[model samples]
Target: MSAAHNASYLSRIKPGWKFGSLLVLSIGLYLISSWQVLLVAFILSVALLASARVDLKQLRAPLISIVIILGVVFILLGIQTNWLNAVSSVLRLLTMCLLAYSVSLSTRFSEMLELFQQVASPIRVVGGNPDQVALALSMTIRFIPELKKVYNEVREAQHARGLANNPLAVTVPLVIRSLKIADETAEALDARGFDSAPANH
Candidate 1:
């Protein structure tokens, strides 16, 4: 993930506060049924990303993917329900997605890890290791961009080979490469004793 501009005001905010606000806003989006309000929210979300000085170049692929998915959703909802519901759903989701990307772009990975660790601390009461939980969650977030890169690379290679029309051509390599990456990450974490509990003093 690209780091936010150091001088950006949003970069100075605490990760916990940003994450909390994102959670609240996401929940609130579901309660909103008016497309007009959602459109305003979408505008504000874009403005938030701009205020954070997020790199739009880095977001190109993800934004394209989101647009495609949203398009499909719009068509399906419009047919299954009503055009109004489809418009509201699309606006709500797009706004939430932009808001989420804003937070991720503005926040540092280390700060996010710290926040996740704190939030997962309660998992210890149920025989779960908070450190592992935090690491898993943090790594998952980190993997998103990596996976996107992998997908693009695989897709391009398939396209060059004239297999662009074959879904399996893309799916097989992407899954294989993703698994390879996951395996390597697991090995690295194990080498660092990431899964081991600290000994009593």
Candidate 2:
């Protein structure tokens, strides 16, 4: 329950799932609607996200957008008494968010690239470079953690400057930092010869 202990616990997720256990657990929880199970999943997801163990930056934008959009829709589009659906939908989304976190935390980028290469082999045989695909995969895997770190640093700096509550202070810097990361990543890939295509002749 202590902050430090919680942080350490979050960082200690097992490197991979065994026997698709997370999936089975999720399914059982969904069917049972057990509050303890859902609560644990929510806590675990938050811990993983905050710890940057699962790398949720890639999901932040979409998740936020979905929440905002759905919040408005629920207020205006729904029958206003459809509370059950709203609760169910929100819980389902929270579970999905945790599921996504689990995937990134448990599955290594190398394993993902290997899977991609297997699927893209025919295309690679024609002209594509699996290496480039792998580079993209690496970036995708790294993108979340890197951006989340940047967001925290930027937010802290803003707070230090006494602009912590200013929306622009957070959003602008976050976007700028994300763009800068994307640019640098692209440059690194190019410098590493990842931009080169396979032989055309």
Best by TM-score: 1
lDDT of 2 at 37: 56
lDDT of each: 0.86, 0.63
Instruction: For candidate 2, list the clashing residue pairs, or say none.
Output: none
Off by over 4 Å in 1: 2-6, 131-195
- Per-residue lDDT tens digits for candidate 1, residues 1-201, read 546454588888898999999999999999999999998999999888987888778788899999999999999999999999999999999999998888888777778878878887887788777666756776888999999999999989989999977999999999999999999988998898775573557
RMSD of each candidate relative to the true structure: 6.4, 10.1
Candidate whose lDDT is highest: 1
What digit string (tens of lDDT, one per residue) describes model 2 on residues 29-131?
5674545556666676666556654444556676788788667766653466575555555555576656565555445545544544776778765777777
Q: TM-score each candidate.
A: 0.67, 0.40
